[model samples]
Every structure is written in C-alpha cells, then in structure tokens.
Target: MSNDRVLNICFHGVGEPQRELEPGEDVYWVTADRFAAILDEVSTWPVPVRLSFDDGNASDVEIGLPALVERGLTAEFFLLAGRLDTPGSVDSAGVAKLRSAGMPIGSHGMAHRSWRGLSAAETTAEFDTARTVLAEAAGAPITTAACPLGRYDRRVLSALRDRGYTRIYTSDRRPARSGAWLQPRYSVRHHDTPASMRSGVLAPAPLPARARALAVGTVKRWR
Candidate 1:
C-alpha cells in the first residue's frame, strides 16, 4: 500500500474466444463473471491499481469496456496490428471506439510473438510497423507497449527505449515502481479469483520475498 508502488493488473481474453486461440492461450481467457468479480475487487483496493488489456480481443470492447465504464474505470488496451479485423479480435473500428471512450491504446506488435531475440527485420515489423498501424487506428500517438508474451531481454528493452516508447509493460507478476519505465504486471488468468488476487497481489510481500522478486527481475533484464 505504499504510495511509491502500484499494482498493475493485465487481462487477456474474456469469455469464449471468437477466433481460434493460440496453443496454451486459453489459460489466460477468463469467464465473463470472473472478470467482473475481479474488477470489482480491484476497484476497492486501497492502493493505486493500474489496469490493462492485451491481445486486442473483441471482448475488450464488447464486454470489458462496458464493465469498466460502469465502474468509472479506464484501462489501457494493447492492440495486435496483424490481428485487427480478424474473427474474434478487435478491429480498427474497435480500436477507435476504445480511444473515443478514453481508453489509451498501445501496440502489442504486428504479431503475437515474443519480443525477445527478434531479428532486425522482425524488430522493425513489430516495433515500427505495428505502432504505425495502431496509431492510425487510435488516431493518437502510441507511445507505450506491452511485450508480446511478456518476453523481453536487454536488447529488446534497449530497442524499445531507443524507439521512444515511454513505457513498456511485462507480465512479471510483481508490484512495480509507479514511475519506472519498464513496468511489471500481474496477469489475471483463467483460474484467478478475487480472493486469490487479493492474497497473492494486494498483500504486501515480506522483505525477503521482495528482494527475491527484484533479483529475478534483474536476472531477466540481463539474461
């Protein structure tokens, strides 16, 4: 509950996916009722909480947006440039709608591939082209990104920084410094419930545990 720290929660698909899910992707898709309940829980947290949705799922605008609006909450949505307009995913119109609704849109890259160790051409496609496509769709500058699959390395981080991304989110499941350029987030998954989230995320970690988590993040940054 320290003012210097913030809880960043991330969501993927909600309910049934309209299009075919990637292998192991179903684990991140939560039931509609579960999503609502989790939102309710987070809304009441005493500490600062930031919300974000990834993968450009159609459910983002369909189900997620309305629920967030009902609670007077807004979340950042990361869009996949390549997946736009495809079945079950948020299209260009949906991206525009989110922007109009006061939701910030960030690039989730051209494809949903990991950002770690990408070749030069792949990096250009993922970072430059995807940001261009999403900015056009959102009608605003896209200055933030969520690493695809929450995978990144030192090189990936450096590339994003050099590309002028103001913020980059990762699914590291740890509380993050509020002003950190590279923010870590706890991703809500299929089996996560309000109780589990409160105990696992909201509760303060012991000093030793916090150190271990920090160490893990350091290792990831350099490995």
Candidate 2:
C-alpha cells in the first residue's frame, strides 16, 4: 500500500446475536473464531489499517474488545445512541468501558436506519441528538460517525459535514485516503476468512477496479 493510503476495516456483531437482528443483518455477524483470525491477519499488514466496530452490539465489548486488546490493538466503536441499554446491544456501561479501554467512541446515529433522504426532524435526531446521547454515555465529545447500513446520499453527507464531524466512515469497500474526512471501509462479513480478507483488502486493487471504486463513491456523494 502507498503511504497516503489506509485500509479501513469495520466489524459488526461478533458471535451470536443477543437480540433480534434486522432483516439481512445476519450477513455482517461473524463467528468469534473468524473475528479473531481476521484481527490477527490485519495486525500483520504492511500498510496502515484503521479498525472500527459498528452497530454497538454487546459482542463488541464481550468478544471484540478482548480480541483487540490481546492483539495490542485499538478500534473505534460506533455506538447507536438509541440502542444503548437495549437487550442484545451495548449499553451505557459498555460504551464507557470501551472508552476506558482506549477505544474511541463515535456515533452510529440514534437508530440503525439508512441515512439516505431523511426529513428535517429525522435528520436532527439522527445527526445531532444521537451524537449528544453517545457523547454523554462515552463521557467524551463524539465527532465521528459511520453511516448506518452503509447507506448515504448527497443530503446525508451534507448534513454530516455541516455538523462538523471530523471523520465520516462508510462501507464503500475501498481503501481510504489517510487524511480524508470521508473514509471508505470494507466491512467484515460472515463468509469472510483471513485469506479472503487479505486478498480482497490487503492486496492492491487493479487500476480499472480502483477507478470503478472511485466512480462509485463519487456517484454516491453526488447522486
């Protein structure tokens, strides 16, 4: 990887779900063993890798945190403010614990709804109030976010920018620019293995594939 490039790896639930999952959400949940192997593989990468956990699943604290700690790695945990304290999700105490363990806390919005074309009120609740709720639980300012369900459009991006989020993460499945405000991430899924991750993420993309990825991101931003 080039010095200016960085790989963003995102995880969702690890192991079994404690609560009911949304439709099609099971694809993002990986087994504990798979999660561990992937972490170990990424730790040996020759390039810069930024790690993050999304959806605020309880496993993030129960399983994910320990694996990361054991590997002497830290990640950003994006908490869903509305889901805090809900069964099967990370609660307020879990959020605090993640922060205390040196993991940065970020807002994953109030609910795990798509941030595509929200109304005015919905936008305020998801973008503004969600950050407030998460910051209070984390006991720190929340200045970053990962789009729910990897969905976003021009309006959504504009709202996040106007809110002054220092970094915005998306499941765009491409490498990211080191200092860019909008970061694209490859989310680990149930079928992904260490080798698949290495070949898919660690290996450099072909020039045509790279161009296609960039075009996709550009379309999402402006469409």
Candidate 3:
C-alpha cells in the first residue's frame, strides 16, 4: 500500500443488538452488527482503508457481513474473551456466521482491562487467553490485537512479541511507518459526515505535490 494514498479506518462496537444512546452521551456508539448495511451506502475512495470493528458483536453476522459481502469489502474484529459467552457478547452462532463470511477476528484482551497498568505476567495472561479464545472461535490464527483502550508501552510490546502476536493496532493519529508493529488507525464517530470521513482517511502527507489535499482536509474537519 502506498503510505500516502492508502489508509486504515476501523469501526468499533459492531457485535450484538443494542439500543442507540442519546446524543452527546457517547462519542462512537454504533450498534454491534448493524453497521454493515449503513456502510453499503458509503462511497469508497480509490485507496480504501482497512475497515475494522471491536468487541465481536452478534450483529456482525446478522447485519454487517451481508453488507460487506455485497460490496466485496471486508473487516476485522477484535474479540474480548471474557465477554464471549456472556450477555451482550457474540455467541457461538454469531461467531460461526462471521467465519463463514470471511471476517478476520483478532484479540481485544481477556477482560477489556487497561493493559498499561498491569504487571508483565498479568498482561501476558490477558493477551494469551484472549488470543487463544478468539482464535478458537474464529477458527484461524489470531495474530493481531488492538491494544486495550489504545494504551501500550515497552513492556506490553515485549509481552506481545513473547506471546507471538504478529500485528498491533493503535489509535494514534500519526501515519504508519514501514516495519512498525504499532499500526495507527483512525476511529469513526457519530458526527462524522461522509466528506469528513474521506478527509480523515486520506490524511495528507507534507510534500510539494500534495499541498492542496492537505489544505482541503483541514477545512473539511472544521466544517
């Protein structure tokens, strides 16, 4: 992927059915499985970003997958092991649907705990358990993780390497660099317009050739 032209955009909470929250109550509260149809209407740019969701929601299979399949688009989901069989978590039927649709689910963590404050052993346990559980559910190698709440340090990185995680996603706004495991992702929210979505994904790099693209993006963000 061309670092400048390509982007990585991901959605959160596309799992099970849930009520929509009141405005201003939450920032990015998309219902877990219902976003697939909504995304169908979105006009993809030439250099599309990788789409992803967090918290393996049941609707991912019921709603999200059909939409993605129709459009020939796909997404990745991060699963929380502790929530797998509990209320509000994606059930066995839901997970099977996701696999059948060809979605790649990764680990979110064992309990959705903050990874930054945990001891090395605690972090390792959390990562390993979630990875194992999600992999078994998805029936594939769960080799990546989106660090819980986007917090990580050297110790967490070490733990990931030891546990054999191959990719790591973060919420950092910076563009990704080559060979960097901490791949940055842009989060979508309720207020973002389609135009704003385009600008956010195509984060312009500073160069003599792309000055106008950068200016247009800045203006779009303020509108």
Candidate 4:
C-alpha cells in the first residue's frame, strides 16, 4: 500500500455470539478477542488507520478488549441501544474500563434498523435514543455512528448532522474518502484469509514491476 492507500479497517459483531434460533441451522459468530488478534497484526502497518468494532456485544469486552490492551491500541466500538441487554452489554463499569484504556464507545443507532423509510421524528428518535443509552453507559457523549447494514439516504445524513454527529460511517462496499458524514468503509468478512485481506485492503502502486513487488511485500506485512 502506498502512503495514500492506507485503508480504514473495521470489524462488525466481534465477540457477539450468534445463535440459530432454530435447530439444524448453521450459525455464525466472531469473538472480539479473536478479532483483536487480527487487528494487532493489521495495525502494525506503516500508516495506522482507524480501527473500529461494531455492535455492543459482551464478547467485545471479554475478547476484544484484551488484545487492544496488549497492543497499546485503541478502537471505537459502536452500540445498538435497544438490542443491548443493559447488564450483559457494555455497562457503566465496562465503558469505564474501555475509557480508562483509551478506547471510545460510539452509537450504532437504535435496534440496528434502517432509517430510509422512517419519518423525520422517527429518525431523530433513533439517533437520539442510541446516543442517550451509550452516553449514559460511557459517561460521555457519542458523536459518531455507523449505519446499521449501511442503509441510508439524504434524510439519514441530515438527521445525524442536525443531531451534532460529526462523523458517520457506512459499510457501503467502497473505500472511504474524507467526506462530510458519508465516510465509506470496507466490511471485513469472517471468511477473509490473510491473502484475501491483502488484496482487498491494499492498493496497488504505479511503480515498475520490481518496485511494485517491493511495495506489495511491505504492504502485505502490514496487513
């Protein structure tokens, strides 16, 4: 990756266990701790981009936190207010620990629902409630949010900006450019292997054949 191609890496649903809700069905779950190990490796790249984990799951505190601590790295965790079981979710104490360790907790909206079909009042309520819950839990205001499922329209951005959210993120299958409340993010999948990760996140350079190889080698190490 060149100096300009540093990708902003973020993980979704870390350490948040998923159950099939029915027997004989497949299930998917990624633990925060296991994902943190991945972050540790990716974060060592020459250009350090922002690292973030989505959804306020118990595993975030259990598995993901320790890895960040070990690597001396900090991340922003987004919370879904209504879906969060207050006690099991990152509670006041858990947020305190994250803050003490230099991590910031953020909001992921209420109920992980899309704001595309909602009215203005409904949109405000969704943003406000999640911010309230996470703010109370973290003892600090949350000014950033990642749209659940990356679904949004003009109204969504307007509501967030009106509510004073300066940074808004989306998992909209594209690379992020510094923009006004419409930052794009690449969602790292559970099935991604080391080789796939390098190709997806690293950008190719415009150097000679040998120089390109060197750039890719150096960038791969960071991945």
Per-candidate TM equals 0.91, 0.90, 0.78, 0.79
lDDT per residue for candidate 4 within 1-223, as digits (tens), equals: 3334335567755544542222311122444444655675567545436677776666567767887787777778887787565544555666777877889878888866777888767676688877898788788888998887678888788878888998988876555554445677666676654455555664332234336558677635433
Model 4 residue 142 lDDT? 89
lDDT of 1 by residue, 16-127 (tens): 8999999999999999999999999988876679999999999999999999999999999999999999999998888878988899999999999998878899999999
After best superposition, candidate 4 residue 95: deviation in angstroms?
A: 1.8
lDDT of 4: 0.67
What residue runs in model 2 are displaced by over 4 Å at the alpha carbon?
A: 205-223
Q: Write down the worst ten-residue block by lDDT for model 3.
A: 16-25
Mind sharing the TM-score for model 2? 0.90
Better of 3 and 4 by TM-score: 4
lDDT of 3 by residue, 80-100 (tens): 787787665677777878778
RMSD of 4: 4.1
Which window of 10 residues has the lowest lDDT sum in candidate 4?
19-28
The pairs that clash in candidate 3 are 14-32, 15-32, 15-57, 15-58, 15-59, 16-57, 16-58, 33-59, 33-60
- List per-prediction Cα lDDT, in the order shown: 0.91, 0.90, 0.67, 0.67
CA lDDT for candidate 3: 0.67
Clashing residue pairs, backbone N/CA/C < 3 A, model 1: none
**Error at 217, model 2, angstroms:** 36
